[model samples]
Target: MTTPIQIGLLVFPNMTQLDLTGPLQVFAAVPQFVPDPGAEIHLIWKDLTPVSTDAVMVITPTVTFADCPQLDVICIPGGYGTDALIEDQEVLDFVRRQAEGARYVTSVCTGALVLGAAGLLKGYRAATHWTAMDMLGAFGAIPTHERVVVDRNRVTGGGVTAGIDFALTLVGEMFDHPTAESVQLRLEYDPHPPFNAGSPATAPADVLARYEELIAPNKVRRREAVARAATNLAG
Candidate 1:
């Protein structure tokens, strides 16, 4: 029997729930899907220890980085922890290593920052939270303005809530458009932002300005993290 296609998603502390949870829900529903057990996905991490998210969520990883099974696809998701994970020696080391053995590497939101830190985003066109997209250029990525961007094997999603779009796109690539459509139907993935302020272009100038102001502090920290990681690479 052909070994099943396995997906390993590395979850770190404070990972955005929507990042992994969105993909998890989409992929888990695959079996009831289209006779596609080969497309199974698992949550993984550096250690099987408990990983806390934001403030009130936690889950013990199913496998450690060293013990992880071979993966056809691996994803890293963004959250507050992504800022730290991007600089963590152990976590970045794991991402760098696992990416070597997987066919595809993917991320969401600032998770692209982690991929950039891992040196995997070099020469790739990618996207992230609009508020943070410019930093990808700093990390040597071709900045993009789309909700989802894929270059070569590295796929990235924008902001915290784009996971559904990213995962559906991934599922389409892994299976077929029919499969993706089926999943979308089940998810009612049709989006309807109540305020019309989701993206920079759609939102009022004042709202966009407010977003920039709010995220300015995070960018300061993000730049510091990028600098430290890049310096490490250079040295």
Candidate 2:
């Protein structure tokens, strides 16, 4: 019998729910698309407790870091809480250990920052939320502006809703295109955004300026945090 495909998603306080949930929904649907060996997905945190997200939703971790089983894939989702996680030694240690054995080490949005903090993206091309793309260089990563990027075993997705596309890509890699297409059909993954302002290049000049200004303070904090994390990794 084929070993079950084990996937673990890191959960933390103040994470963007969509970052975790979007990819999660696609991975969870794997069994419906392809049977037999199946897939097992788990929410991993410091403890098996409920964690609040950036939005109104709260998620409970299915396993604690200490108790998490060996996983085939480790996915870290991004959010405001990533600032704290970048400097979190315990969390970084857990991620580092898991990535050592996992077939794929992945992230969505700012979650790539967490992977960078753990020193997993060095010399690899990765993707993250547009606002934080340049910051990847601080961790020795080549930042790419794309919806999803795969460099070796490190697969990263761009901001927010890109998680779904990232997960579907992962499914296609693990199974086949037909299987992923079927899952996408099941979820009715169609996009037709009324606005064409998803990125800095596409957004109106005024809108882009406003977003940059709003995130400036957080960006400063992230830079400092990433520098410190890089130091820790080097040490």
Candidate 3:
């Protein structure tokens, strides 16, 4: 019998729902496209309750931290809630324990900050939301400004929607190019953005400035949180 590939996605309050669900849909479809894919995804949290997301969506976790099965892949998705998670020892401990045995440790957007808080990203090249890319340095990670970054067993995606690209990349890594391509075709994963304002370099200067100003307070909070988390990891 083929052993099942266990995958866990950590969910928390105020997370960006797409960050967790986008990759989930891709991974869930693997069994149909690949023979005996054996991929099983579990939504895990500290408790089994419905967690509210940044948007109007809410998700209930399938398992608790203590009862989660040993995983082949562990993924963390980011959102506004990440600021609080950076200082959460329980969540960090859970991530540390799972990462020790998982084949892949991955993150989307600011979720990398949580991984960093868990001491998982030390010396790894990772990616995160563009706004927080520089913050990876506090956790000893070399931050790369790309949609998806792969360094050894650590794979990370930038921003919210990039989780789709990250998931496809993981599929390619776990299976093959053909399998990933097949999944992409099945999902019609094609990009044709009407505007070229995805990145700071491409965005209109005024638009970018407006967003920066809007998020300034959050950034300050995150910086302080990262500092505290880094200090905790150091000791």
Candidate 4:
């Protein structure tokens, strides 16, 4: 029998729910698409305790870092939690160890910052939330402003919604284009946002400026955090 593919997604406090769920929804459909070597997905954390996302709901981890099997794909989902995760040496170490053996090392949104902190993105092209794109250089990464980026085995998605796209891309890579297409079709993945302001480039200048102002303080804090993480990784 073919060994089952293991996929682990890190879950932690203050994570954006969609960042984790979008890709998860896609991965969960793998069995229907690929029968042999089925996928086993795990929501991993430092411990088994339930953690709250930035949204209203809470998610309980299925596996602790200590007990997580070697994963074929290890994904880090992004959100405000990453601000703390970048400074967390324990989490960084776990990620580093997993990346050493994982077939695919991936991230969604600011989760890329966590991988960067773990010294995994250096010299690799990566994608992250647009607000955090500039910070990638601190970790020696070339930041790409795309919805999804695949460089070697490092797959990164732009922001929360992009997680779906990222996972579909991975599905294509792991199985086949037809499988991914089927998964997308099953999910009814067609998107037509009511507004075109999903991106700064597309948003009106005034709205974009105000949003930038709103996030300015948070950006300052994140910049400092990234700087500290990058320095620690360097030392």
TM-score of each: 0.93, 0.98, 0.98, 0.99
Better of 3 and 4 by TM-score: 4
lDDT of all predictions? 0.82, 0.94, 0.94, 0.96
Least well predicted 10-residue stretch by lDDT in candidate 4: 30-39
Q: Which candidate wins on lDDT?
A: 4
| Residue-wise C-alpha lDDT for candidate 2, range 118-194, written one tens digit per residue | 99999999999998898998888999999999999999999999999999999998889999999999999999999
Selected candidate, larger TM-score, 1 vs 2: 2
> Worst ten-residue run, lDDT, model 3?
31-40
Task: Encode model 1's per-residue lDDT on 1-235: one tens digit a residue.
Answer: 4566788888888888888888877887676676635566678987778999875879678888888887888888888788788778888888888899888899888899888888889899998887677778767889888888878878888887888888888888888899889999998988877798888888999988987898789788878887887777556
Candidate 3: stretches off by over 4 Å: none
Clashes of each: 1, 0, 0, 0
lDDT of 4: 0.96
Error of 1 at 182 (Å): 0.6
For this target, which candidate reaches the highest TM-score against the unseen true structure?
A: 4
User: Given candidate 2, what's the lDDT at residue 147?
Assistant: 97
lDDT of 3 by residue, 48-155 (tens): 999999999989999999999999999999998999999999999999999999999999999999999999999999999999998999999998988999999999
Q: What does the lDDT read for residue 190 in candidate 4?
A: 97
Query: What C-alpha lDDT does candidate 1 achieve relative to the native structure?
Result: 0.82
lDDT of 4 by residue, 26-141 (tens): 99999987878889999999999999999998999999999999999999999999999999989999999999999999999999999999999999999999999999999999
- RMSD (Cα, Å) for all candidates, in order, is 1.6, 0.9, 0.8, 0.6
